[model samples]
Target: MISSRGRKIFVAIAGAAVTIVALLCIFPFWMVVIGSLTPENEIYVRGYSLWPQTFSTEAYKLAFEDPGKILRSYLVTVGITGAGTAVSLFIVSMCGYVLQRPDFKSRNFFTMFVFFTVLFNGGLVPWYILMTNYLHLKDNYLALILPMMVNVFYLIIMKNFMRSIPGALIESAKIDGAGEFYIFLRIVLPLAKPALASIGMFIALNYWNDWRNGMLFMQDETMYPLQYYLYRLLSSLDFLKSAAASTIDLGDQVFPSESFKLAMTVVATGPIILLYPFVQKYFVKGITIGAVKG
Candidate 1:
């Protein structure tokens, strides 16, 4: 048996190791925040520092120059994330529950079909045509929400998580005159909270960070999601800088490009970072749930 002294020593080492790892993970983001406040010239001169050599809010000012657009984009992103996560979660969980049922004879076939899509898809041109020409999703809010509403990876994760639920519990619910939907809602859902929270967070993040869909299907400026809006803004700044440099001799630190990048990083990631702490407990549980289950 290990002695108490050895255990205490081990604990101390483990705590120190965890602290170091945590700092390592957080240090890049901390540098980004500091660099955003540092002047572009100062960044070039001194490089990124824990403390800025010369502080400036120029990057943030540039970012917020058109606060109205940013606010509109924020609203659009939040709506898409909230709606998409909810709809996707419901569909994934229900499908997972249904497929895991032993009595569901077509489960294997259906599971194979879902898994097949993961390995092979019809490619980008067909998908684009389907979304635009066939589905009429161009410039539509459904353009943002519908395409991501059901992720095959999330469905697989949900299925695996649901498979861990004991058949006896479901049978007992049935014996108590519970319908399939009732059993799924009352028993399976509560037990599957961890998986649901994890997958919901994943889906929300996907919607929040998505720019490709916006780039493809959206034309209206008012319809831009936060990520896409910021991307366009940044791209415009870069293009102007390039054009001006080509014609007139604009100085090296003219546009606050580096700091603007850092600032936008801060802006884009702030909400999700704030959100993570609340869902982290469930996320941790979900990752480890059913790990040992056959």
Candidate 2:
């Protein structure tokens, strides 16, 4: 019903808006890439540019020269992310399914218990002392996985999504002589794939990006995760003071610290950036399911 001129104008405006937003998001990343490839001396002299005036692989070479540390950290991060996601998804999904069941007695009380923790957390000092002194989890990988096992907000979102499933489905499953665990594993879980995938990615990203836990609990440099290793490298000038310090002499090692920082940032972010597209559909679907159901 619109005139040809008006339709063209509307399309042009929308296209321009999208282009502007896309450029805003992409320009910073481009700058980082250019800056990282730019020689350290050149960056100091010429300042930042969209294109590297003198491109060099020095930063990447320094980063990967003794790939042992980075490789170990990658293994630790992968293990934590995979294990944590599986455990967290299982616990949260099961809890959420039970919480959403209409006939479950004391469900309101259980929900409140979970929700209350979100509002009022135990203080940091107490948590640190408890984990380190009481639980004796310091320097252990469990410290990374156990503390973040259940996120209340995610549980609430999953519960809300589960509530949207027809009660008749669960009732029929029950009548078919299926146990609760069997029903959950076989029927409910399959239907909850979108929510599970979204929450799984959320948990995995948390584990992968976790540097604070490593800093707090892991005293041994060898146990340090990738983010923590990168953090220490970026912040500390005397990188020889920590793990793998003895591998390179302070006098002989020539590290482009600034470019190295940028390079590490790119490496740490690369996985999630690649993963976002694949998981984006589930994320959208999960949010829509939660919003409509909750």
Candidate 3:
């Protein structure tokens, strides 16, 4: 064992290292907050500031001048994120369980099939055609939800995690006359929480942040997800203001484009910030276990 001096030295070095890393991670977020709150004139005169010289809510005001659409977008995103994560998690868990079963023949073939999709794919043109023409998902919520429901990488991780669970558990359940579905529901589902939570968060984030599908398929103003709406606002601030000008009276106020972007960044990222901490332990553990599960 190390002596007291060595231990103290180690602690000092570790503390300094962690503080540095923490600053690196947090500084950008702090800047986002500071920039969002800073007055537009302050930003124009002197780029970004670590701390706002003049605090103002003009950014948030410009963003939410028409709160109806923003609220609708929130509803759309929340609905999809919740529904997609639940459905995707259930399907992925079942797939993982099936692939882990010792007696399951053709599991190798199916695994290869799944993995092959990851390595090569039809071009975006064909994929877009399939989604729009055949699936007819254009101007639909399914366009955003269905394409990302399963990830090959997450499925393989789940398979490994399930495999590492002792076979005796399955054998015991079988001996007790539990049906396959029953065994999966009562036994496997409860035990797979860490892996489930990990992949579930990933799926949720994907659905929450998805905009490309909306950009590609959706044409209706009512159907825009939060990210997609914000994306349009970021792309063309003048268009946003001009469009809103008729509905809401801007009066003498200018749109807070710079600060508005930062504000949108905060709003778009808020839920994940609240969410990730709670699942962080499970996420880290699940990844570690999967990596070494063989």
Prediction RMSDs, each to the true structure: 5.1, 2.9, 2.9
Off by over 4 Å in 2: 1-14, 240-254, 290-294
**Model 1 lDDT per residue over 67-139, tens place:** 5556788999999999989988998999988988889999999999988988999999999999999999999
Compared with the true structure, all predictions reach lDDT values of 0.83, 0.83, 0.83
Ten contiguous residues minimizing lDDT sum, candidate 2? 240-249
TM-score of each: 0.78, 0.87, 0.86
Highest TM-score, which number? 2
Task: List, residue by residue over 91-191, the lDDT tens digit for candidate 2.
Answer: 99999999988889989999999899878988899999999999999989999888889998889988987877888988998999999999999999999
* lDDT over C-alpha atoms for residue 160 of model 2: 84
Per TM-score, what order, best first?
A: 2, 3, 1
Candidate 3: tens digits of C-alpha lDDT, residues 220-271 = 9789988998888778867455434245565686655688788877877777
